[model samples]
Target chain A: MLEKNKLYTIWVYLQAEPLFWLTLTIGAFLVGDYLYKKSKLNPLVNPVAISILLVASILIATGISYERYFNGAKFIHFMLGPATVALAIPIYKQIHLIKKETTSIFISLIAGSLFAIFSTYFFAKLMKLDIEIIYSMMPRSVTAPIAMGISELIGGVPSLTAIITILTGIVGASFGTFALDILRVKDMTARGFAFGLASHGIGTARAMSRNETAGIFAALALGLSGVATSIIIPLLFKLINF
Target chain B: MLKSIFIIFLFQLIGESIQKYFELTIPGPVIGLILLLISLILTKSTKNIFITKTKEEITTTSNFIIGYLSLLFVPIGVGVVMHLSYLENNYIEVLGVIFFSTVLTIGFTALLMEIINNQFKKHARKK
Candidate 1:
């Protein structure tokens, strides 16, 4: 057995640095992503889910606080902006198709945004949920960064928005294709638009794997949905006094 | 490889500049995308770029990045750790809102698209 003095020294050193937590989070995520891909369960195997599990396990076992982990993990968070920017390349490729379907895309985005906002508010009221939780849930379908920002603006917890966003992605990835088929969405544009509006990036990924045309429309819808939701949700909230 | 990297950076730079100068609500990458689309349209007479070796390279690169895209959220997940108090307080409301809104959004968007597509088809038939 190790001596008590030596064990205490090691524990103190480990607790002092942020890199220890950062490495664990990223390493676990990469491993989880690889294993999930290899397992062939489904492309819907959300890496975010696996990463959350891994981190939660580590936190519980090691008695490390979340604040310590975030101290170093913030670097990875910075990449989200660049990644979103990179999405432009794919969207640029489908500009012509986007131009042709612009009207329909606009209409769908408006309808979708309204539905996302009102339905959540309505359901929260029915369920007797608190006002803050309703505010956080309002931006669940939007991308995480934007959702987090919106959550803050609406007096909800940004962290709750993040969790809600992940759940939305998982649900979108799992049910999106089936829903499309059940609804008999035959047109490639409509299918892509539906996926993007509903699931955001995960749904867009599903669309990209199917066909180029679908991929293009998915990108357009994803970008447009973000813009439309950002504008419409805020305005609607004010108008509705929620 | 070098050319693709250069083009991406150039577009990103242009996008960032536009966003900074104009205070547009649209993100920089989006503006860069519009620029690229304009360029592509103007050069439509040129041969398609996706036919050659470059297509293979791009597809491979994009696939690799897309595969791990979800992993990039770990940091954000970690950030959520800081918000546990808020989550504990608002869990029910949050879950309820997300579930109902997602279902409604999907249903409404799909219906709207169906209507628009039907209208377009009807117009085409009339023409």
Candidate 2:
């Protein structure tokens, strides 16, 4: 039989409001994901869009503090590490293809990383953004934890970095295919690599839905871009005096 | 299933130990991933075991988890609420940076990918 203490803990979690929020968020995402899989009107079915709407509506209606929601939502956060690790399984399956395309992957990553960073920096300067804001924006293309760390290192607001990262992911997931078509990017490898490099995990998720090869390349790009950005952003900040 | 979970935890343990001991720039989970990959490659048989065992669990868990991943941002977003004053003060600059950086990152990545695709095709033809 379960102990009294364990029962209490379970009861507390069951009563937690954040759990409800998380459930709603997950439910909405599943609906969106299912719809995307079933229909060709892919843009409207974006899980991120649905999630943002659900959460925003809840927040507006209840006036629930983000912290209150986060208390229950952190269970979902803890899974990110394991989810990232699980990416290795898909990556392992495609190891043979990865080896064959090592050169292209290398070139793609280097070019993609540089272009992502420089263009953000260049455009921020053109727009006359404050130095701190520019620094915060520098790591926007990478995944969240790394982006937050880079923002802190380069004197950008971590909170702002988080917002930008989400926006980047959603936009990437939404318009990524259209962008590829406009550029006439037909190769699966290039499409996947570009998506992952530009959009991180969310982009990789979209890639996985496309094909196995694309998924593998996307995961690799996501991991590599995260690592590279963490190293490069701080150095670039120092060199450029941002 | 239990064994894969054990292996994952063991790898995570090793990763955390390395991080605690050396204080590396990389996160422990990432290091754990690398270590697991290397070990799996070394004992190739375990790769089959690991995949077979965790296949279904990982798929279901990944599906359930991916949707809620965005909620992790809520805390950070709420931080925006707490810092309304700072945001108001720096509103224009903050909004400008977010807008331009996102657009430019997408544009440049797409452009660079096209060039790389063209070069890759050329090299493939030579081969």
Candidate 3:
């Protein structure tokens, strides 16, 4: 009975600790990455998306709450802040490219950012989504942290905005290549900026993996659009009395 | 690795402080990033030997971190699970808007930029 009880205690301890879920998150990501590579880097089969599915399902199967899973995972979350600051490295390296194309880049940033905001708002209303949902979706194109702040300021739910922003990123990263090709977007800078502006970090990741120039431009635009949208979206809303 | 990471954290700290001081909605890390970039550029142009060496260190460390950037996002990405109930309740509209809008936004931005860039090239050639 003592030996049998020892096995049960070990299982309970595994369920209760952060280390198990942390390992599980990393393991799931490795599996997802392997599958992504095996699939020839198919965008549709995104590693992050796959890992999320695997980890979430495992949590569900084990009857673990999302809160507890996050407790183990928050260490990784904390790193995103520093990583964001580190983006300056790539942007600095590509400063020349940014300076050379300042005119077109600024134009593209304004047009694309406005298009993203207005289209999302119009469509959400067209779909008859709740007003709160509309507000949450407004900043979906921005980086996660910035988007969450924008959502809160607009009286939307921050958590919902975060999920929507991530979903937008995954969608953009996954389908971006195909869309760029279909649109005949030949300029690497344009391609990179588009993905970065619309999809933020994940899209930047995809761009970086494709080529160096693409990654640099993506980083530039990712940072630019975040700053631009943070200021512009709020002003636009206030001006319209929204 | 430790030094590079510390440098990044220091920038992030400075960024956060400025953000709070100005009551800006923009994140501190981003502002810190721009400050870092400007400082790096200034240091590079001045050709400071010590600064150049540190820049190289930052470059190598930043590159390594970039490689794992996606990994850093995994935890937040997984938070999607917490919103499953809300998503389930509005699957069609939510998913539809996300899918179509993402496709449209990417297409429009890329195409518009490409068109503008080609025109600029054409104008430069004419000059």
Predictions in order: lDDT: 0.68, 0.68, 0.86
In model 2, which regions exceed 4 Å deviation?
Answer: A1-19, A38-41, B45-127
On TM-score, the stronger of 2 and 3 is: 3
Runs off by more than 4 Å, candidate 3: A1-4
TM-score of the second chain, each candidate in turn, equals 0.72, 0.66, 0.93
Please tell me what DockQ candidate 2 reaches: 0.32
Quick one: best lDDT, which candidate? 3
The candidates, ranked best first by lDDT, are 3, 1, 2
Each candidate's interface RMSD: 3.2, 3.4, 1.1
- Model 1: how large is the Cα RMSD against the reference? 4.4
TM-score for every candidate vs. truth?
A: 0.77, 0.81, 0.95
**Inter-residue clash pairs, candidate 2:** none
**Regions of candidate 1 where Cα sits further than 4 Å from its true position:** A1-27, A34-44, A152-159, A209-213, B1-64, B81-84, B122-127
What's the CA error at residue B122 for candidate 3, in Å? Answer: 1.4
Comparison by lDDT, 1 against 3, better one? 3
Write candidate 1's Cα lDDT for A1-242 as tens digits: 56998998887787667677667877887776676667663545656667777887777688777767677676666555445555655665666767766788878888777777677778878878877777888877777656776778778877777777777766675566666677777788777777777777766765665666766676677777777777777777688777
lDDT tens digits by residue: candidate 3, A115-201:
889888888888999989989999999899899999998888998898999999999999988998887888999999998999999
Docking class of 2: acceptable
How do the residues A155-237 of candidate 2 rate in per-residue lDDT, one tens digit apiece? Answer: 78987777667666766767777767766766777778777888877777777776667767777888888888888877766
- Range of the 10 consecutive residues with the lowest summed lDDT in candidate 3 chain A: A13-22
